[model samples]
Target: MNNEISDDNSDMIISDSDSNSEESIEDLNWIQTFLEKPGNQIFVEIHMQYLTDRFNLVGLNKYCSEKMSTMLKLMTDDIDFLRGEYSSMSSIEKRMLDKECAKLYGLIHARYILTYQGQYDMMTLYSENIFGKCPRSACTGTPLLPMGLYDVPEQDSFKLYCPCCEDVYRPAHITQGLELFSGFNGSVLSEYKRYQQAFDYPVEKHLTLRDSELPLGKNLDSEGDDLNIINQVLKFNPNIDGAYFGTTFPHFFLMQYPNVVSGEEKPKQRFIPAIYNFDLHYNSQILRYQELKRQQLEEKLSKEYDPKLIKTKSKKIFTSKTKMYT
Candidate 1:
């Protein structure tokens, strides 16, 4: 009888261990794949904690429907089924749910970036311009911060803000379906000065025609017309090389002369660039001042547009074929 009892106890212990192992494997099946990816292992604890409280997921429901909201909860609320039927669901269904889950996580991320921890995680990427560099030649490859025009999802996609130009531009690279809130503009921008100090990104001074008293439309038929115009406006010879300085000049001149640099200039459609068919409104006084200066320059240029110097088929000859904005 004593031997039989010991055998029964050992059998029970073995059976329990097997069950526990199976459960562990199931739990690992989904999250383990993500955790195995580079740079995600460190966030294991934090990600788990983010899903622990419902409060952290506020405002997520507005972006998803009833069914999707349920799926998001099932995926996040339960520690055991964190991946939410990824193995059992059909591929199409799994993809749809996965998309919603990802968006929900983006909403969470937007909120997270406002916090101390998320800011720390994003600081490296922000400083590195992993999102993209500013498209403007004047910005000089400055790192960009991702921001959304609207806080609501599906209303708009992400935009990149250049700290140097203090203007937002569409990302140079296509981001597919990634949507985020404008939380970065609020929190990240508020802390940007501190970030610059920490990263040793010295504030750079860029020359602008706005502050200069330049002869805008003088001597159109003169030798070295481009250099003469630039020199008079910039007040210093910026070395009219076919590189950075060359690219920078046309942006200011493009407004006055549509094909100033021909193939190099972005199509002169609008003064303020648009993002995904949405017109971007500028609140920056500096941009306003620059636009005023550009208008003044155009007025002067218009007075000197000799029919011999500048050929025009129509009054508005410039039209954009591409959607890219600088």
Candidate 2:
């Protein structure tokens, strides 16, 4: 009886050892598998979705209006030959359309880089020409108004100073206007100084263009001319270089997509496809950001999580199994 009891005890010890070893192996395998799965390996998708939803296409459009307008004009001009009756257009017209589409693709690629880089640069060369300069002391205690002029109070105007040259010049008279000093040439350095001072509560000079000098009519006339040219080209050849039919051609093609779709003849939805693409691109960016964030979080957790706690949990799992078997 004593021998049998000793043998039984030895067998129990061996069985417990095997069970613990198996559990450890299983746990390690699970951890390894979790680490290996591509999707599970990181929070890339979450980051991408966050990026996509965070990026606003409307905001991008507003930011790039001038650039987009220029691109549209160039595209229209390139495809002018194709904007007539199909029967009237020759082989040259087809060739021109193809060339214009290719040009547009190049333009899109270049513009994407330009716009992205401009965001980082903060100083837009286009805005400088279009909106003009912000006066030195326009709003002493307010945000810098790049696209508009601020009215400077007399009390605040006296405190104006240029941070660059340390010029303690008082705000110029409202009538004098903040002249882009002839020698200054509106360099980035000057602009940065002006922007910095504007952020602070420094006084600013307010300058307003006279109503008669505004050139409102000239601006309208230019826009009208552009529209006329676009219309003429569209009249000649309705197909807009095959890239969604130019910006203006969509309004007329709305009915062509009516639910009679059997083949790829489906008309493109007004804005959804482009919007979807934008969202996808935006989401992808967000996902990347999230993945980076997640990685940081994981690293932090790894450092902060006590190995003692994991060991304790493992002991509980193994100890409970030993108790049951014994």
- RMSD (Cα, Å) for all candidates, in order, is 26.7, 34.0
TM-score to true structure, per model: 0.40, 0.16
**Model 1 lDDT tens row, 196-308:** 34333221211121223236653322424333322222221111111101112213223333332343232323355568866556644556677788679877787667674
lDDT of candidate 2 at residue 277, scale 0 to 100:
46
Lowest-sum lDDT 10-residue window in model 1: 236-245
Query: Model 1, residue 137: what's the lDDT?
Result: 67
lDDT of 2: 0.28
Give the least accurate 10-residue stretch of model 2, judged by summed lDDT: 146-155
Reference-based TM-score, model 2: 0.16
User: Which candidate wins on TM-score?
Assistant: 1
Error of 1 at 49 (Å): 1.6
Model 1 segments more than 4 A misplaced: 1-46, 66-87, 173-326
